[model samples]
Target: MLLAVEGLTHRYGDKTALDQFTMHLNRREIVGLLGPNGSGKSTLLRVLSTLVKPQTGRVEICGFDAGKLPEAVRSRIGVVFQTPTLDPLLTVEENLLIFGSFFGISGRALHERVRHLMQQFGILDRRTDFAKTLSGGLRRRAEIARALLHEPQLLIFDEPTSGLDPAARDDFWKAIEELREKRSTAILISTHLFDEAERCDSLILLHRGLRVAEGTPAELKATIGGQIVELVAKKPEAALETLRAKFGAAIELSDGILRVEAKDAHQMIPSLVEALPGEVLSVGLHQPTLADVFRKVTA
Candidate 1:
């Protein structure tokens, strides 16, 4: 196991940030900490990265206890924070070399490692450019390369693609996939984006500092099995009551929209339209998605 966390709990004053969270990851596995902001994803990442001591629970990384052997754990894991870390004044190659030096790597070894990582992340062509001169996507790639300079077995990313265009985000993920295949590194990333969560091998969904759900994307979506029928009603409250009477508790109202879950949702559309008459403004039917699953589990 590359990473293992059990009964992890933390607090800030009176507010709890994480509660009895437990999960594990292995080499070559991509695990996502899926949640919205303030969902304890960042807290958990801090604890695992050995920056924050866990008030309770055990965090073991690559056979090293995070609390007891933080230095050891730190040496074996790389962290890419949510915010940019590169020095704007330094060139890309210079930034990597400086970070590598901090890890006690220097001279020919550091130079070789920086070169390899730049090439691997497709930032070799931009090495001579100052950090401030690179685009958002190129800067991000440099940061990831810097994190891997020491070749850590596990990589921890906190909202890695938080501020990038769609194309840059896609490119970032492709690099991550290639890294896993080539280095067999274990990745534990925190992300709120549904598309990014869908790409993970498995996901642990957190909501308000609690573990709401945990499984593969397919498994989580399966929990909301069948189809989801959504419609905006002219009279939302009245339509909700009407739909509830006909569809039971499966019918719910959110944001002035009526949602119904059923095995044969398409067949129910006509019935729903007839029941509401002119009350429904529009209707849509689709299979379950990560967003739907999150809404259901959090609801």
Candidate 2:
């Protein structure tokens, strides 16, 4: 394992931030940390990155203990925080070069790496522009470029697309996938976005500072009764009780949306329509998605 953690725990006075959290990461894969806000996803990342001390636990990377050899672990890792923090006074290339030099890359090697990252992220055109002048998306890209300058073996990101528009978020995710293809970097990230979590090879989901579930997106989704049937109707509230009473443990409605979890959606649709008492707007049948997994486990 490139990264390993066991029995991790942290607390903010009386509230526990992590409860016996244990996880591992392969040498070259992106693993997402998923949960709602305050689920301790970010807290887990901080422990892995050695930003905050865990009251108890052992963290190791490449056989080096994280608590005792934090410097060594940090040197081999690149972290992109959720918030953007590019130096306004420095040009994009200059900012990247500065961070690269921190890891001891300099001279000709430094320039080459900076150029490659700029081009790779589609920001070569603005290489000479100061970071403060760039838009939110471009600045976030520049932040990513800076983190990759040293070619760290493990890369960690925290909500890389939290506040971006749809187009920018798509572009950011593309950049991350491209990096994975190029370097096969071992990545760990904390994100609330369901789409982001679904893209990961595996996931650890936290709910209120505890590990509620852990698995690949598909695996987790499969545990939610196999199938998801979405029933759309003109009178969702009026029909909910009938569906619930009939289906019992198999159905629920929390937000004007009803989910019917059964072995076969096609077989259940006829019974569902009969129970509903309005013009059916539509019906969708599919296997459970990552969102469904989160909702079922967390709700």
**Best candidate, TM-score-wise?**
1
- Per residue, candidate 1 scores C-alpha lDDT tens digits across 175-267 of 778779998999999887899999999998898889999999999999987899999998999998988887788888888888988888889
Which lDDT values do the candidates have, in the order given? Answer: 0.89, 0.82
Q: Write the per-residue lDDT of candidate 2 for residues 43-132, one digit (tens) a residue.
A: 787877878766798888767888888899889888888877788999998899888888999999999999988886678999999989
Q: Pick the candidate with the highest lDDT.
A: 1
State in Å the error of residue 21, model 1. Answer: 1.2
Clashing pairs in 1: none
Question: What lDDT score goes with residue 168 in model 1?
Answer: 63
